[model samples]
Target: MNSKIPKSIDEYIKNFPNEVQQILQTIRSTIQKEVPEATETISYAMPTFVLNGTLVHFAAYAKHIGFYALPSGNIAFQKEISKYKFGKGSIQFPLNEPIPYGLIKKIVKFRVNENLEKTKKRIQKKKSKPNHE
Candidate 1:
């Protein structure tokens, strides 16, 4: 939440308090554990994981942590996430509440699969297209 754009996830996490730092790292690890091949970066000033496209993005806010797994991810898990505060592509997990690591893992896995499927379709589309060259 500083003016400086964190070059890496580590830098972004360090800007938070110890408790928030712990939560952020746990979320990062949960995503990585689910998809070992996912790449990490700082996107939109938050810690982001990318596979075929962005897997997920998370950031610590004053009273809550914002978890973004894109619109598809949120929509797919609508029932499970309904209890929490959510948006088109984002979920706000309050700091006072227990962070649902299990739910986070599920969401990450879903996004990983979704992203991979998109990549597959893109490849198939290219294969079906007539060569112009």
Candidate 2:
């Protein structure tokens, strides 16, 4: 693990090699295209985008770039992401192979919608709760 924490995604990407930086930038742009309103920040030591809540996160690794769209997004896009290596909430796109920018865009869009819906439900639930005094 890197001891030096990056202040921004640009700084994070700058630490990597040119090839890795390009892949990271592509992932960032794809996510931005999906959720232009989402706020960008560093969370969990990675590039995180938050809308209603944490929309998604991405990080560059030595061999692969990891995309974290939360567990629900992985379950929702199982068919597409199955082609690549994935964990509960993260997918690994290898640096040697072509990154699936299209699928990444879809996942980001899915996460944005999920976050929005969850936020809406949370607000509604709060509104319906009886006053405790």
Candidate 3:
């Protein structure tokens, strides 16, 4: 795990190899463009976007890039993303393939909405609970 936290996502991307840096920059920009309010941070040694809550996390790997939208993100994109390789909460995009920027944007947007909905539901649940004396 990288012990240092990047000042900004741009700084984080700059630290990677030129090729990986380009892809990472694209991913970072896409997330920022879609979720303007998202805060960039280093979490789990990877770059993470925190919106209404923790929205998504991405990392540069040896042969591919890993995008993680935890909880149920993989399940949501399973069918649509079957062509690409993936894991529990991650989807891997090989360096050779044209990076799927559009799909990545869509996934980030989906995660933002998902987190917002979860927050709303949690608030509603709290409101419905009777206060104990």
Listed per model in order, the count of residue pairs whose N, CA or C atoms clash below 3 Å is: 0, 0, 0
All candidates: TM-score = 0.96, 0.93, 0.89
- The global Cα lDDT (0 to 1) of model 3 is 0.85
Per-model C-alpha RMSD? 0.9, 1.5, 2.0
Writing each residue's lDDT as its tens digit, candidate 1 over 1-133 gives 6899999999999999999999999998898899999899999988999999899999999999999989998999999899999999999999999999999999999998888899999999999999998
Using lDDT as the yardstick, the better of models 1 and 3 is 1
Order of candidates by TM-score, top first?
1, 2, 3
**Model 1 CA lDDT for position 97:** 96
Candidate 2 lDDT for residue 109: 83
For candidate 3, write residues 1-133 as lDDT tens digits: 2548776666678777898998998899899999989899988777899977899999887788888888478788788678888878888888888888888888888898899999999999999999998
Candidate lDDT scores, in order, read 0.93, 0.88, 0.85
Please list all clashing residue pairs in model 2, or write none if there are none: none
Ordering by lDDT: 1, 2, 3
Candidate 1 achieves a global lDDT of 0.93
Task: Give residue 99's lDDT in candidate 3 (0 to 100).
Answer: 86
Worst 10 residues of 1 by lDDT: 109-118
